[model samples]
Structure formats: C-alpha cells, structure tokens
Target: MTFSHDGLRDSLTMLAAPPYFYENLRRELATAERNRSRFTLIRFQLFPRDEQASLASEESQYELAILSFAEVLKTSVRAEDLCARLGRFEFTVILKAPSAVAESLTSRVVTSWSSHQEWSKTALCKSAIVTAKIGESSLEILNRLDNQELIGITQS
Candidate 1:
C-alpha cells in the first residue's frame, strides 16, 4: 500500500486513485524484467492508516512533504533509475541491470533514507523486493509484494 498525501494513510489496492499508479508499476515491472534486475516496491508506512486520516492543512504543505519524499528517494537511488509514486508514498523503483548490484544499491538507499530528517520525523517508508522470473510480468511483481513472507526484509 502507498501512503496517501501528507497524512499517515494508504490506498491498499490503489483502487481509489487515478490509473497512473498501476501504469507506473506496470512500466517499472516491464523495465525490471527486461533488464534482468530486481524491482523493489518500497512502501513507506504512513500513520493514521484510516480513511478519515487528518488531511494536512493546506495543499502547499502536502506538496512540500511529497517533494521532500522525492528528494530523499533521489538521494537514495541512482540518477538513471526510475523512482515514482506508484501509490502515494509507495514508490516503484526499477533497479538498473544486475540483480546483485541493484540489491546493494537499494540497501544503501534504504539505509540512508531511514536516517534522513524526513523519515526521522515519522513520515515513514518500508521496502520489499520482488525479482522477476523467466516469464513473470509486472502484475506478478505486484502480487509477490503481498506475500507476507517477505515482510521486514529490511527495516530498522
């Protein structure tokens, strides 16, 4: 689930928002499969997980938070990589070629972001990786993410 806006909330199936999210996930999955790299959907667990979650006072503040999230994400990831809002705070990143290399890169990104000022303040993010099999597609990656077995792969 991706965190929603400036609040500690998420859209489970990404059913409530625009179709862009699914589109982004689908694109990232395609890229991952093609490059033979691992695609990890890092979902930042936001607070106030309820629908009636308190909305940030103004859209401006919300935008700042979103930008801040992006900043941290960029610093954590590679410039050639794709880090997008798959759902609110849920971002889908297609690690560049080589699964091992990608995994290492993601580790550093996660480690750095976890201690970043933004995350330290409680606006949280969690990560999980889904590797592509010979015939797997993006949807498969999405399904794999729901597998509880992968929970807490890397989080402090």
Candidate 2:
C-alpha cells in the first residue's frame, strides 16, 4: 500500500490518518476475501472524565492525554496491525487476527491505559470490536460497529 506523506499520519499522535485507515481497511477486506481469513476492527473513543472539567479548558493537557493513549495503542498491538487516529478523540485498529485475540488485546489495552496514573484521571476510553464479514464493505462494517455501544474500560 502506498503511504502519502500528506495526510498519511496524524500530526498530534503520529498515528495513521483517517484516509490511511480507510484505505488499509479496504485492502484488508479484499485480502480477507481472497485468503478466506478473518480480521477484527477495534474502535476507540476517549472522553474527559465527568469530574475533570478543567481538562476541557486545558488544551495542552487534553493533547497530552491523546498522545499518551496513542502511545499505549502503538505499543499494545503488533507492528503489522494498523492503528489510526480517526478524529480528535477517536482511534481505530485493524487487527489481522481472530475475534478472540482481538478481544483479549482490547481488554489488555483498556486495562493498561486505565491504570496509567497520568492521563487516566483526565480521560476514559470506550472501545468496540467487530470482525469483518465475508461480503461487506469497509463503510458497512464501520457503520455497524458504530451502532454498538463502546464498552468503557471498567465495563470491558
């Protein structure tokens, strides 16, 4: 896959950009179709803690929380897995692994991130995991996944 420098990576987190994420998702879908393989997509949303009103006013702190969470994601998944920043407080991972493995990793990541003393107090993460179907487009899968309630770190 070609990686264009422009919009290839998020400037704040240095993770894959939205365009890159979508492209990779499409490619992974095709690869799964061809090889009859399975892959899982994990979506993450980070929100400031309800009691942490100051976090919203402090831009630097908010950015640092995002950056730190991104680092945790980068370190948690395999190098071949695609990790992308979908929005200001959203991220995704394309894991070329079975649903079980994906689920385990998701739990592990949430645990690790929540236990971090620095940013955990300011923000909390909610995540959802969906495995790709045989005959589905990237958008279709994403839409379905989006409808599901993202499980919070404590809930996971």
Candidate 3:
C-alpha cells in the first residue's frame, strides 16, 4: 500500500514523499510503455553494515546520512530525473536513460557516497538498479523492490 503526505514534505531528504513517488512511477510506467523505451528505477537503502547499528542515536545518524546521500543523488542525475523518498530509509530514482546509462549513474552515485567521509562513518548504503519492463505497473515494481527482488530486468 501507498501513503499520502498531503502538505507535508519529506523533511530530511527534501525529495518528493511516498504518494507523489507512486504518482510519478505511474506516469513513467505509462510513458515507457507507450514509447517502448527503456528506463531505470533504482532503490537505495541505508543500513548499518557495522557497529553503528548498535548506537542508540542510529536513527538520527541515518537521517543525516540520508540527507547527505540525497545531495549526492541530486548532483548525480539530470534535472529532469525524479528522486523520491519512498520510505524512511528507502529512496527511489527514476532515470530516463537506457540500461547502460542507468547502471553507470547508479555506480557513480554509489562511488560518491562511499567516498564521503560522513556516510562512510555512519552506515552502509545498499542500492539495487533495475529496468522498467513493458506493461509493468508502478505498484508491482515498488512491491518487488520492497521485497528485495528485482522487478523488471535486473541491471545491477
């Protein structure tokens, strides 16, 4: 199921919140199906890969890490692309490029975040990049990502 933000913005990442993310996903799916073009939907999740997970302040640190990661995302993609906070620790990026470009973009983003001192000190961020399949719906894609399964063709 999806959620509604109404007037509330995603305070941390400053990206479009859940409901809007679903809306954009729907539109992108339709456009991809119509044009028979390839696009990518990437899911990023920030989780502690080390002892940081034992900290009581891990939640706030995750927020800060995500905020910094969002900045990385904004700089990595074109202005026309969409980035949204689909859940507390999950973000989704819509890339209008082909599979190769999308994979490159994802790799670039991962590299950028990995090089950042703050993120490196905070948590390990995992990402999955996948292409949108023809006739696939937005909800199905999201469900697949939530389950850690590749929805369309797995590009990563």
Task: Identify the leading candidate in terms of TM-score.
Answer: 2
Please provide, for model 1 over 13-93, each residue's C-alpha lDDT reduced to its tens digit, 9 standing for 90 to 100. 322233544665566666656776555454443332234544253445444555555666667676665555655545555
Q: For residues 13-87, could you state the per-residue lDDT of candidate 3 as single tens digits?
A: 678787777777899899989999878888877766576354235567666677788898889989888888777
- Which structure is stronger by TM-score: 2 or 3? 2
The residue-by-residue lDDT of candidate 2 on 1-156, one tens digit each, is 122335789877889998888899999999999999899999988887866475457788888888899999999999899999887788899999988998899988888897887788788888999999997999899998899789886732
Which whole-number lDDT from 0 to 100 does residue 137 have in model 1? Answer: 65
Best by lDDT: 2
Instruction: Estimate the TM-score of every prediction.
Output: 0.57, 0.91, 0.82
lDDT for 150 in candidate 2 is 91
Give the runs in model 1 whose Cα sits over 4 Å from its true position: 1-63, 148-156
- The per-residue C-alpha lDDT of model 3 at residue 145 equals 61
Q: Between prediction 1 and prediction 2, which has the larger lDDT?
A: 2
- The C-alpha stretches of model 3 lying farther than 4 A from their native spots are 1-8, 51-56, 147-156
What's the residue-level lDDT of 59 in candidate 1? 47
Over 4 Å off, model 2: 1-5, 51-56
